[model samples]
Target: MIRILLADDQRLVRAGIRGILDDEDDLHVVAEAADGRAAVAACRELRPTWC
Candidate 1:
């Protein structure tokens, strides 16, 4: 699986991205962040393959 970290201030934007990526069997959204800081934190915590 391709782990991913999604960051966006808008909830809809994040959701939309998640939805789109979720359709792919080889891709996964491991974490979602509302800001750059949270995104960094999530990346550190999840350690995604493509952060």
Candidate 2:
């Protein structure tokens, strides 16, 4: 499976992207962040396999 940490300033954009990515069996969104800083934090915390 492909783990993902999706980041976007817009909540709607993140939601939309999560929806699209979730549709695929092999693609999984493990976390979401609204900014670069948060993305980095999430990356550190989640340590997604794909990251």
Candidate 3:
């Protein structure tokens, strides 16, 4: 599986992207952040394959 961290200031945008990516068999969303700082923090904690 490929882990992912999605970061965006817009909630709808994040939701939309998550929805699309979630349909894939090999993709997984492990974390979400509303800003760069939070994204960085999530990256450090989750260590997603794609961030």
The best candidate in terms of lDDT? 3
lDDT of each: 0.95, 0.91, 0.97
Off by over 4 Å in 2: none
Best by TM-score: 3
| Tens digit per residue, CA lDDT, model 1, 1-51 | 899999999999999999999999999999999999999999999999888
Ten residues in sequence with the least summed lDDT for candidate 1: 42-51
Q: Which pairs, if any, clash in model 2?
A: none
For model 2, state the Cα shift of residue 37 in Å: 1.0
Off by over 4 Å in 3: none
lDDT, ranked from best to worst: 3, 1, 2
Clashing pairs in 3: none
RMSD of each: 0.6, 1.1, 0.5
TM-score of 3: 0.97
**Tens-place lDDT digits, model 2, residues 1-51:** 888999889999999999999999998999999999999999999987655
C-alpha TM-scores of all predictions: 0.94, 0.90, 0.97
Clashing pairs in 1: none
